[model samples]
Target: MGNSSSSLKVCTDHQGGINWLSLSPDGQWLLTGSEDGTARLWSTADSQCRGHFQGHESYITFCHLENEAAFTCSADHTIRKWDVMTGQCLAVYRGHTSIVNRILVSKDYLFSGSYDRTARCWSVDKEKPIQEFRGHRNCVLTLALYSSQDLLQDSEEEESEEEKLSKDFLVTGSTDCTVKVWWVSSGRCHQTLLGHTGAILCLILDAPNRELFSGSTDYTIRTWNIVTGEQLRVFKEHQGSIICLELVNRRLYSGSTDRTVKCWLADTGERVRTFKTHKHSVSALKYHAGILFTGSGDACARAFNTKTGILQRVFRGHKLVINCIQIHNELLYTASHDGTLRIWDIRPLCKRGKRRLKKERSLQGRSSQKGSLSRLFNNKVGCVVHQEDGREQETVELM
Candidate 1:
């Protein structure tokens, strides 16, 4: 299939590389954090920069949006909340003695993980830590939250059981090459999942399916049963390190230093397709519905078909490699390596129709013998091609 990089449009410009991006849960705004020590809020419809907050002293690593307020974690060793409408600093939660790598938010609590080998849970409203979870031996790279429903079903019920028992759980992946699941309320360790040979970069839970996926620097993606702590499968084919992963439907999507994104069947562990979207290492990926968005060291953000493995669009405006991308509603937010966060009005671009593949001419030579024809019988050869509309194009060639 012919590649079409020009079909994509650039919506905005950010001089620095982005670090992290998130869309407001209400679907009204977008937020981004960057190495420039700033985070910005943008209007979803027009991609207008509504406001920018510049209180962090170092590179901002992560951002989470809750209601109308946004929270950010930075190498400056601080976490700050900002007003989405006016970009005003609402509160700063600071206590970590080292650079913070990641952050997670629930309805009532904010969790921050750092290189100091600790994770702290804070009150979202009061903006203070209520509990400190300390045990890991290295930098915490990622954290995932499990719903209360998961805990309720996992525990054995008692005769005098409390119906509305408080339940909260968090999973953290670290450079220590382990994934730890913890009880947030009691600050207790639930389970430690050990498998990867290198540092774990990302961990995600498909709570609906009771599956956990982890991407690591060991060049593999490992799937595990969250309840049983059993290793389900390991996908290992990349030539370099695997950095990020996202799952949609029953397929698993992963990005690697091999400069490619590969799709795999979650149930069979079979490789479905592979696409080279960036020239450098892919750092992050986000998938919503059927569209896949990726950020990489190539200084670009790209959109590709999740099924057919076709590169549909290439967004080039960041001065350095993009670190993160998140789409909420119709707006796309990208964080880059240079230090700035950029927002785009992607509603128009997101409405792309299905891709059409060029039909291939079939060979017309016929078999001489009836027995030969029966032995060499071939059905229509069809290949699934990627189109911009987030659907596959089946090109069938008759022989």
Candidate 2:
């Protein structure tokens, strides 16, 4: 691979790999959680560590950043709230019996999904949970919130009954192969979406379109009408489980265990383009200003053209798989299993490059993934087969 290291800066304060990343509302700072059992704050401008909060006994898994405070979940079966200005542990919220996988913060409520097969909603200032949503037969893997405030903020359309049905609704995706929608205020189950054959890994909402898009281990992406609670369409293109979803400019993008990124028409669910370039399973993705950012278990992050799905520039720093990615305004942030966060000045790479790069997709099919996080992390050695000659080759250890 060509050297593009000079265009980016890496933060190396975390002793273990980073699991989650979030940006402040003002886009001035970044909050990241790591396997080191700590969450650190980084100044976006300088790409330097400003502060760290340590308390969790196990790996930190998820993070949600708001204006004054940041919330992080952990494998320690607890969630800690930290002051954004001081990096101090303000309060700790505990209820889940298993690892907390994801968190969502709305106006006055904090929601968490866990391996305990339930989702809980907690008050921001209180230590105890206000409500617990229980029904899934397996672990909850992801969480998302859709509020009436979101629909009113951007679109010029007038308010409708569907928009006023509930002030806020919480969506939880689980390993039970189902998604549950609940009203936050009353804790009433609004709808139960069931179709996926495998676990739901990631989800994203389209407020303008009033739709919910879910990616799953079933190798399918499904779109549903939020108001009607009906499955509108399904996009089936990825040969492996989808782990990440990005929506931009009325287009939906997905990163899959198949080591590729696929783009689709948000309205029609038609596949637009598939960028097959990663060397291992893709773990994260972000689309901003016509550029696509992807992170993979191959221990590399790459930038791709949204229109043509062509490779642009490669970012090499992480020694392991990248876990999450975020873009605040002009800056690009990536968290990795290498215990580092990287900020890349993408302005230079956004321009035309000297060589027109073609995507590198191997003919060897990806192995089926099972269990939560197994596709992104494995301690045991793996094997790779050469497609051209039927020869078994030992896979290089990336973690």
Candidate 3:
């Protein structure tokens, strides 16, 4: 209903909407996959469109940036590796029976989920899949890594384990209404969590709390024990599909097709607050530095206070829906249906208005309780600063 205070700076305009965004671990550049059948790299500092890697014949659904290299999955049913600095397609890995919807990487291996209803594990360098994991009955919509605890527990049971348990396992959610955890190394299914009556839209692992949270088209959010495959709780407040769930510290933030952002107790299924921040369906959500960033089909990325649920700043830079948002260091990056990516100076916003408001109010009190509002708000209170002077010593809260 009101104009957004923060301004948007466009970084690049591709031929199609950017679907997913990833930042290089060093934070030097950004990698994005789009429906244009390509992945592009942009310089973080200058906002320059550096290079584009093109090979996929269809929409690129996801991409992951690692150092100077990147990996992408596409609706074309293939995964391609690229040299980020040059934008050259270095290698192509093809084996999926349908569109590759997601791609994930560990230290040495790559994992992918597809519309073909199978998840595959591949060797990153050789571009060869070592094993195919088949269990889900429908499209694998989302994939997430599990906790070290689950991985260790699964390994202890095998008399002779072929899978070298990485520090984490993997969770794959599908349209068949099930979430499955797999042994990363052995490509074996560990647990299958079922309850949702509709398609699973998102799957997230809160390793610190040892729990998994999922959003679904069934208009519910479900929590489960990652190790035991036990259904912990179900939150049925949203009237529409819960498209995205953000876990900051312990607080659970969910964006929904109902055009609202709901805050909940991460560990328990208790509702804390509900606030409307978008004109239409909230397609994506991200919370960082005391700010909740949400992108909507209304063609804007809006920021709100994590604790107060008050509007902080609205960034309107795209002409179409924003699909995903990721924050790195001082910059906020967004991928949009307008076929472009943009970056903003988060320090300016986080250090000035709403950020200062958060520190002054102490809105988030201290608590170790999992999913408490305190952990959600206080975790992003910005970096504290202490200054010394000759006349008098004083402390200034910059953010």
| Candidate topping TM-score | 3
Residue 376 in model 1: lDDT: 44
Each model's Cα RMSD: 8.6, 15.0, 8.5
Could you tell which candidate, 1 or 3, scores higher by lDDT? Answer: 3
Q: If the candidates were sorted by their TM-score against the true structure, best first, what order would they fall in?
A: 3, 2, 1
Q: Residue by residue across 1-399, what tens digits does model 3's lDDT show?
A: 434544457765588889998888998888888888888888877778887888889989898999878999988899999987777888899999899998888777888999999999888889888878888999998999755654345433443434543455778999999999887667788789989999999988876556899999999999997767789999989999999998876778889999998988776778878878588999988877677889999988888876567787788768899998888776788889888787776776677644566555452222113234444555588522222121121111111
Return the number of clashes found in candidate 2.
0
Candidate 2 residue pairs in clash (backbone atoms < 3 Å): none
Structure candidate 1, residue pairs in collision = 16-338, 16-339, 17-336, 17-337, 17-338, 17-339, 18-335, 18-336, 18-337, 355-387
Per-residue lDDT of 76-181 in model 2, one digit per residue for the tens?
A: 9999999988888889998899999988887777889999998999988877699898888999998888876764355454545654565788899999999889
Q: In model 1, what lDDT does residue 58 have? A: 88
- The CA lDDT of each predicted structure is 0.75, 0.80, 0.80
Model 1: worst 10 consecutive residues (lDDT sum): 390-399
Model 2: how far residue 235 lies from native, Å: 0.9
Worst 10 residues of 2 by lDDT: 390-399
Model 1 RMSD, rounded to 1 decimal: 8.6
Against the hidden reference, what TM-scores do the models get?
Answer: 0.80, 0.82, 0.85
